[model samples]
Target: MKRIVCLLLFCALSSALPVYSLTFAPAEETAAAVADFERGQQLFHSGSKERALATLRTSVQRDPGHPKANQAYTLIGRIFIEQKRYPDALLYLERIPAVMRSPEADLLRGYCLVQTGDFAGGQAQLLPLLGQSFSVQDTELLLLALTDAAVNLQQPLNALFFIQKALPLAENQASLLERAHRLLQGHLSDIELEEAAFMWQGTAIGQDARLQLARRALGQQQQQKATHLLQMVLASDVTFPYWQEAEMLLQRSSMDSWFNRDSIGVLLPLSGRYASYGELVKRGLELAVREHNRTRLPVRLVYRDTAVEGVSTSQLVSSLTDDAKVMAIVGPLLGAGAEEAATRAQLEMVPLISLSQRAGLPQRGDFVFRDSLTAEQQIQSLVRYAIDTQHISFSVLRPENRLGEEMTRLFVDEVRRFGGEIVDIVSYPEEGTDFRKQIQSLLWEDYVVDIPPKPELPEFDEFGLPIEKKEEDKKEPEELEYPLAPFHALFMPDYAERISVIAPQLKFYGIKDVTLLGINGWNAPELVERAGRFLDQAVFVDGFFSASSQPEVQRFVELYRQAYEEEPTILSAQAFDAANMLLLGMDDATVRNRDDLRQRLAALRGFRGVSGTVGFDAMGEAIKQPYLLGVKRRRIVEIN
Candidate 1:
């Protein structure tokens, strides 16, 4: 049986016939004709429509009087209808003798006639299949024919009636049935469709229907119904597309009722190991708020603790919600915790500006904003500094892992963008202990060729034994080329330890003329100590250029020293900036809403603060240019 099935499959796949063709044979050829017809029917059922048609047509040619011949002809007509070949479809369908014309045949014939633009004839043919006893599929086809004919004649009411009639029969036809219902509703008067849509909005099947109605209402400036429908959608699923719209409507409604005051919330971690950083953020926020208050801006400050280990996240959030009653939130310097708090604030319909640098937070809602620069942004800054300020034009390096690989890619991209070139890119295994071989391959300084030995001379010893003189082989120096000289710079975005190891080796190989550029990861104390002499002429871009003399920066340094008894890092400065911006934007009553705040932030032009002049681009990224810093006398110094 398997062998026979395989043979039949092979034949069906190999043959070509009209998509809906069918064949049958005479009862006199009984067993053979029956087998062929059955095989063809199976192929048709399996979606091999053309092969099934050919096999069935062969059966019909061989035995025209067989009972299956009429069925085969009907099937062939149906296949043509399915394939949307109306002309060819009509030819095959008309051959189904009158006695074999069932409701399905009449439906197919109506469809073909409609396709050929004979609306009246198609309508007349399909009218009989609208009876109660017809199957849903047949009824659906009948209604389709009627709707097509009515639409062609510009009788939208008639088209609507047919669509309504088809809806019940299309219950199992999910997407198609919904589309038909929507079309039917669209044809009715506004009042009528509105009533029907409202009725459907009460049932499970009506959710999507109601959403469509709401969309239409919104489009027509019917705000009340649109708001109601949007609310219903949100109540049903907060993750619905209309949820954001609903939230906006809700906010607008609230504004209309109560626009007297503005509230702001700060989510700094004031009671943990990161408390000092959070306090710095709070100070910036306080300064902005003070300025707002003195200017008589309609704004208020509400603070929340995002303590890492001292309090549960839930309790902290609850305290903010119940005690603070904030309209917007800012701070929470840690990444994961800050993200969680931000998400909660969004869900609660409060705006949140996160101070962390983590990527992949949801940016869809207007309620969440990020103020830190991403790694890619930093890479761009470094690349720009290398090209624009330092005039460095080339790089050579190896990535330690995937992140290293990404850094290499970003560096290369920036180099190309700045009209520079990557002379050599070397990669090594992160776990490998021996980098000598990899370095040798890249530096090409360890090759030697064989030298011929001198002829030996024989001498006689005192014991009369012949003594042969053996000469020591002379060593030849290996040839090495310095590739870094032509290029003005070299980039090494690796761990400080590996960099410390490689830099000295690079200098030993006579590549000391070129400046060595390092990435953010190389800004560490260990690199200076380990690669001291080797790094004498090297220059790298650091996040924090500690020797700046700008008044604002100097004040920041003084304040940070006063508060922490130590100088500030770039991370602390960025945290300060995030806090400052969040609070400054909150000074306006219009910024109570997140979208308004985003616009305000984007419009900021050269707003000077602790971390140089801060502004934002369209993607909510900081736009401050990075400074070029070099290691001198074992200290990081800004290159004016």
Candidate 2:
């Protein structure tokens, strides 16, 4: 009877305690595990992750099924997570038996699963804990983890839901919204977008969704629905982050709004000191419009003189935008005036293809575009040709004025970019007619030969008895001659008037047999007539060559001659191309509004214009392959 009572008491005590009590291990081992677990908890709570991890490992080793071992595994995994050792965290976290998992254990395991790309398993582990009370930081981490998993799973709506919940807890609300917008747009289907808009109604996210939908509808030519959606947002009391954008879209959707798809405004200095240049641009624009109307729907031109005495370019731009309702404007031929027009056009959300070669006109806004061939483009074409012909070493003879200095700087940078070297750079006065000294420096003639030593006299005797100097018959000093500097090419960035004189002088100074590179200013008739023999086989870049044999050039020349009874200049050709770009783009059914036209223009590629093959870069700057011409047989001809 006594033995029976003792056995029953032992069994009762084992059951009353932990499962480890029934294990075959000694009580001392179980006690040590408890001690280690206690110490690890202290270290973990005190933020000594490394020490706590070691102690917890020891605890698990002492007795695998110890009650404290479960908590020990959890703490160890959490420490690994703190160290960003996801694999190690998973190794320990999964060791906890399913029946032994505490909420904290499950959370750590969820993170490990997610970190190791087991997103579905992690989601399953984390979903049930959403309602549990956790720290604010833990809750945010849990929500973000879920968001990531959903995004990777291609569940944008679910990801958006998680993001929306996490917004109030996010430290940078703006950054979070931006991320949401980027992730959600174009990812959600139409129905999903409508659902999302309803889910986030009266909020910036909702307005962004609506705006995106309106844009899609506009792209598909669903103007009536797009207008209603845009108007709904405008009528709302909520202050949208993109309220101005929404209003712009609303105006774009209405046919009566100031965005006529078939009307173009012409802003040029029609009656000023620059009137001749503007007249050329006007003639080109008229020809383009007339030709376009002959084949397609009639496109009207509304001319607004940018040269009115008391009116500013901004006022002119505004009038063209508001009163004329032109889809796009084609000119403001001067740089300063173009900038002013660009600003006002941007403010009014109108597209203006500026003809000015202003350095940063395109940077004014997306609505501002440039169609002129810039100096940079000229230098690029010239240097590319030089490099292609195996001419690596270069010399620059530039004028010492602002335009000259600017062109020289551009040339130097371009040559360097092509892995070519500038051996020497010499400049002459812009207004001075003489380039002899500058050319001499370019040839290194000024520093080539050392001064000849004075003729030595015979040593005088002690009594100065026999020293006598004989006067040789005086001969005119032989003129010093210099070999051309060791350069493969010479770049001259000057006007035709200056080049004509400089070209002949270059030959006079023994600068023959080297390649000559020039800018658009070298394309004049007199340049080839006066200095053609000197500049024979010399390469230069121009924006237009009316004498070319290309079919487009012939057609343009024929039309211009028949219309205006004259040849077309670069200015006229470029203006015609710009006008035709807008006119031809409007013929597409996809271009329903000014904004639509803006996008079409921005994506223009390989548009073969008479000036050259024209396109627009991301910043709305013209991308063109300028005409590369060379003087051959005393005549300017295209270099194929």
Candidate 3:
């Protein structure tokens, strides 16, 4: 069997077909606008495109934000696209607000752009839709458009991506087959042809691809391979229109093969030094699988423990891949383990979502996803909130360590991005308890040298000799007046243990009025118990907070407590959310494949889970909007 080489996303867009878009119910606007839009839609459906366009225009003029207006614009734009009126279609489509526009509208717009020979812009719009749709029809349609654009752009491999996905979810198999035949006869080369053939291996299109491969084999004088491929094609369902053709080729001579498409691997350190952490992750996976049990897909969970004293991360993953026949892997929490698994997974083309926070982990490849929160996220969250609250100037009190330095850089970048200033950065020894010097330096900045005081001139006696000021005769000078600290916000992106001590010390040193900014580490209860009064109104961002009153979050905390007999740790929350996302994506068998899983992860948006809102960036790194919480009455409270 030919391996589906996913060398480029561009190759996935190898052909074009009718794409679908999303639609929403019209908001209650002026009855007239609604009526006009409804009428326009009816007319359009009734074969009066021109009348419908007029009515839609009238409706939009009355209330552009109305659902009716969006629907009308969508219809009008799509009609113009079908008519090859690219400019008109774009004009109509652009009127609908992005938030209100449907996937269908976006797809149609892309189609129109492509039709006008704007292939790049067309693909730009269409590519993002890969795993977003809740509807298979929408997905198929979008894939079709991508395939056509890719083929036209001479990226036949891109066509393979679209067709393979389009094949499995094809409600309109006839349409896909027709497109495939056209692509095979025209743009596809031997390699591209092989890629497409393997994508649809069991489906009807697979048979077509097989037939082509066989013919190519015959042309190449490889009679045995030709007969084998032909036999495979003939073995496909007779419902396919070309079954007879397959038989004719098969009778010449051949061979065959089959594959099992069930099982995913869960690799965790279940019985070693990292057992506790692995257990938390495992619970999350178990919960996710239990929840997904309702779907009843044939896929099974194959669990492997990478924790055996002698078992290396590579060995553990290899066992699952070679022996277990797993489709994807979720695993090993430690950075070293995650890196090993990532390298192996990337090399093998297996999808792996590592719940490790190692910097540059996901950079290993497209197949490796770092679902854990990163240092950048922690610092960026603190900086963003500080800026949003109009805190223009900031100070940093970080530990003298690599983490502190890393966070400091990230904070500085974010501050500049959002137009804020860094007043001072003071780093104390990581293990130091007394930060008096750092705090003093942050405030006073070596005042003896930086702000030298002028010597007092005493009154001279009758003689010209310099007279020393007597204790009884001279007046005493008042206390020195210190300048106010330059910054209004102080960022400390370290753990609560050190932060708790540092925060109180800052107050003792009179670093008042500056908002105390921290990352998830400060979300600990110790921060509240030890420094709550000091940090009142102080905000810290976190990926998960059990204290959140959000109903879903509350439910998760409760369930976690009941299941684990303790409060859910950040590890549990993050792992649960990550696993949940994978489970949800796995609902579609067609999308459960390693490559498909990665694509689906990128397409996830605003996925609300125990670990706050979870999404993935284009690079497959976690994109979470950290919850900014404040200390109030000795309790952590959501800071809006």
Candidate 4:
């Protein structure tokens, strides 16, 4: 069945070839040139592109003035284009005599220019071919060229005019036409619409008039006619441009659609030592799925154990890929496993939502989305809060290991960039026990000594007390004083226990005015309990703050508590986010292809999640605004 479907799809794609004009020569042409031209045409029709190109080139060179030669030259250019040899194609195309240059030649030349990265030149060549009678192939290629040129020129709105003009020409090439139509269907800004239309106008028009009509009908909200037209169009060519959109729309029109159901997949490290985290993630997924289903989301949740106890990552990927029913795969939260999963998901075109902090994973596939916050983003949040919200001017602290070192470097760089300064940077080994010396050095204390140059005979009365009698009899020695500048804030990248010990000692040295700041790692209870009074005024940035006033967060917190009987961690929130993102994108499988998914994900906005509002950038990285929290009465309290 799969093979049959694949074969059918291939046939559909093949039949959707764009229309192209075929110019015939006048009887005045030389017989040799005419014979060569016919032979080249046969070769082109036979798919012997290289031989066709050579024959066509020879014919054109032999009889440059012959109409047959001009036709052969145009055909040769198209052959080169099909072979993606744009430069060679352009040379032959340009050889066509001015009077022999047909619309097809101009279209082919335009396509070659685009292929050769001369978008502006291609646009100039193609604009003249607009409104001309063209083959579906020629029209589709021309529209594609126009769109590419417009986009390259950053004139998105200008692309739309070309798309509208080419829409009717795409009768036979339904898929290409539909693509062009869809590219312009949305409420695109002037620039975007123009660019999209221009790009579409360059492509060849397909023969499927019904597909074009359906797309137009759909654009006009003529749902029933659009659906019927699309169905008719797909009966002949399922790979039509509007095929995916039609299918999705048809499914949507039905009350019971797959999209309305709770389709979820959970990825976890069920077989390794991190099994506990996996179980936690599974619990979160289950909780969210259940709640979602209860709301009549019609959802179903599935779990995949990304455990390679003895097998290789390849084996794990094979196991996962075998399950065609899986919609979204989440987990394998371990860094190595997540990386492997990312690569595998990219290959399989499955969305793998990683729950690990390894931000170095290159966001590749649309299906391979991550829920983890990057260190750079986290640092930026902290810096913003410190500089803007808290008005902190100076920071003095140390980082523990390589990660900490990198974080410290980022923090310093951001601080300086944000008009802040670093007063003192104390580097401490992770294994260091006593931080007192380091703290004292940063305190900038002044040492003063009072002594007499020569000791006078003691003029003591009863208790052998050397009480000075007169000011003249007393002498003062020179005193040296060292001044130390005070820092307004301290950024401690250490874990809770170390920070706890360092915090109070800093206060003891009359540095109570210095506020303590910490990173996400300091959100642990151990840090609060061990640090005790020292952490009273300290602030930190954390991912999961249950005190959020947002209803989504409140619901998530409640549901999580009911399922796991424990508070949800940032990891759990991330898992939830990953699930939501995958499900949201699975709405349109046609557009759910890897690249499409990646673009959609990047353009997502205002998506609410337990981890806060999650959005993605062009690189497919998650960007979430972190919450600022303070340790108040040993509890993490959100600071507005």
**lDDT of all predictions:** 0.63, 0.82, 0.73, 0.64
lDDT for each residue of candidate 1 in 2-96, tens digit (9 for 90 to 100): 99999999788646433333443344685666666888899999999999988887876676546676676677777867765566667767776
lDDT of 2 at 486: 75
Candidate 2 wrong stretches, greater than 4 Å = 1-256, 449-481
The local lDDT score (0 to 100) that residue 575 gets in candidate 1 is: 55
Model 3's alpha-carbon lDDT is: 0.73
- For model 1, state the Cα shift of residue 226 in Å: 8.5
Per-candidate count of clashing residue pairs (backbone under 3 Å)? 11, 0, 25, 60
lDDT of 2 by residue, 1-640 (tens): 9999999998886676655435656789889989989998998899888888888899888988776777888888878777666777778887776766887888888877777678898889988988988777778878888887777777888888888888889887776676576554435778988998999997877887887677657545578998989988888887666668678767766754456777899888889799999999999999998998888889999998888888999999878887777888988899878888887776566778999998878876657789999999999898888888899999998888887899989887777655577899888888878778887888787677688956755758699876664567434567766575679999988889999999889888778788888899899999988988998858989999999988998999999999999999999999999998898789999787776787788789989899984789756789999999998888899998
Better of 1 and 3 by TM-score: 3
Q: Which residue pairs in candidate 2 collide?
A: none
Better of 2 and 3 by lDDT: 2
Rank the candidate models, highest lDDT first.
2, 3, 4, 1
Tens-place lDDT digits, model 3, residues 1-640: 1345653433554332112223323455457788998898899889998888888888877766554667888888877755555667888897766766787888888877776668888999898777675466567668877887887787866776687677778777776676665455334567877877777666666667777666555434466887888776766564576666556446533422211246668888788688888888888777666666766664567888877777788878777766776767887788777888887765444667888887777766556777777878877777767667788988888888888898888887677555567778888889999988888888865764544656877667788778886679765666765557878888887898888887788788777777888878888888888888888758888888888878878988887777768888778887778677777777765673454565677678978877764687655678877788898898998877
TM-score of each: 0.52, 0.61, 0.57, 0.54
lDDT of 4 by residue, 1-640 (tens): 9999999998886565322213334544456777888998999899888888788777765566565666777787777667555666777788764555788898888887776678888888888887898777677677778977876675645555566555667665454344444333322443443344345432332313344444444433456866775565456532444345456445433322111123455567777687888877777676666665565446676656667567655456546544433545676677877777776655444456667777655443334556776677778887787777555566557856886788888887677655476777877778776666677667654332444466557677698887777878566765643333367677877777777677766766546755678888777777767766777778788777777887888988888888778898877887777767765765545543333444466578888877864777534567788877787887778887
Alpha-carbon runs more than 4 Å astray in model 3: 1-262, 294-300, 448-482
